[model samples]
Target: MIILCEGKHDYEFIKELISKINVKCDVKDQGPRDKDFIIGHVVDGKRLSYVPIIIEGGKDRLDGNVRLLISKLRSVHGSSTWVLILRDSDSNDADSAFDKLRRDIVSLINNPSKFLLYKPSMDCGQGIRVGSFVYYDCDLKYMDGVVHFRFIFVVPSLEVFLRNYEYVNDDSRLHYAIDKALSDPGIVMQ
Candidate 1:
């Protein structure tokens, strides 16, 4: 399955998680702020890279390539591939970010003849509110050959996931942030 990532740490973490599930995933190095890197990778069968930068006058980290990628993926894959947008959490504007993303998703949904989005969410990486929580109790669904959830916050650092993981499942690396999301306790933005 192809995963469009926005950060290197995200690449590593997702690589590890998918490996445990015995899924072979290609991870392109999408730097901390690099947003256009995934556009080419989605349409091409090759390893790619990009420099991290923010879009001009926009909260999104792209230079209009994100829409292009989405359009191309829909045209080429045609509802048989998964385009997962792996992004960072904007704490100050988390709600707004989600709202805008949802709106964009609606536009994609109208074009059912093309590929449709399965799960699209901006994870609040590294900056999850201290008392925030999220929960979903299911085997999680898969699209094409990938299984994706709309969104889930995580600590980017392996050290951080390891450090706080024991507070949940002490033995499994993938269980920390995942378990936290499944049994989120405390005040949340919802």
Candidate 2:
């Protein structure tokens, strides 16, 4: 499984969650030095899963990063891989962000009709919306084989979700919110 997210904060937040879950994962720096891509592997019984939580630097780079990563993973892992994209809604609502991301991904892949689209649905407790699309059977034009793409939108932003407060415009405050969440394991339950 591959997890692609929006920045250092998101990357750290996810790394922390995986640690809390007792998953045996090792974080390693992958790709170019300028790009922040972290790779980890989770051992589940006899199976080992490559879970790369890639930081695309910012939301603006998400579309291109997704396209590039998916294409590369298709060549390597093929139908065995599953990708999960995590991003914040920021100024937009969750539904709008989900729609935009879905469109962006659909536009990137070849023969969008071959994949089965799953509409976004709310996870009421977390206030997050999730959706996915799956490609099955033989290889296609751009894609080598089957692949699963799933996405999640953190309502408004990660800081808001973590702090349970209104959106903070300042970058420092956003970092502070993430820092606080890192210290409080209880924040994950809330």
Candidate 3:
């Protein structure tokens, strides 16, 4: 599984969350560029390589970047890998944010074989908002397989997660780091 975050700070925070929850996975930062594109191709029927396609226009073109990454990934590989896109709901309306994200993802995928939305249950300040789908690429003869993609929105920004956790020290630092990064011109929420 590849976990894609908005920036370096978001990636670090997610790394902490994954460690606390004990989930073994590879986490990647999407960088500060307006669009960050990563592609992977199946080799020897074994694994995939991370190849990036960078475009200009900064944060405004985020959706385009994500779509490119998904399109390229699905076109080559199968459902063996799942992509988890972790985004922040900076404005407090997670539903709308997720809806827009879903639309963007669906637009890139012709017709996903499976699509599901899981609402967040903010019980005690911890929750999860998830959108899952399975899309197939018809280009590769032997690679006519599906790729699973998911979008997870962190409510009110990722600060909520850091504040609710027990093991993290200097919670204020974590909060400031994420907030500052998201406030930058290179960061886009919708």
Q: Kindly list the per-residue Cα lDDT of model 2 for residues 46-67, writing each as its tens digit.
A: 2234456667778888767865
Which runs in model 2 stand beyond 4 Å of their true positions?
29-50, 76-78, 110-144, 165-190
**178: Cα error in model 2, Å:** 5.6
Residue 74 C-alpha lDDT in model 1:
35
Worst lDDT window (10 residues) for model 1?
133-142
What is the C-alpha lDDT profile of model 1 across 151-178, one tens digit per residue? 3333232334434544333445455554
The lDDT of model 2 is 0.52
**Cα lDDT for residue 133, candidate 2:** 16
Q: What is the C-alpha RMSD, rounded to one decimal, of candidate 1?
A: 10.5
Give the per-residue Cα lDDT of candidate 2 at 2.
59
Cα RMSD for candidates in order: 10.5, 8.2, 11.1
Give Cα-based local distance difference scores for all models. 0.39, 0.52, 0.45
TM-score of 3: 0.53
**Which should have the higher TM-score, number 1 or number 3?**
3
Pairs of residues at least 3 apart in sequence or in different chains that clash in candidate 3: 34-58, 34-59
Ranking by lDDT: 2, 3, 1
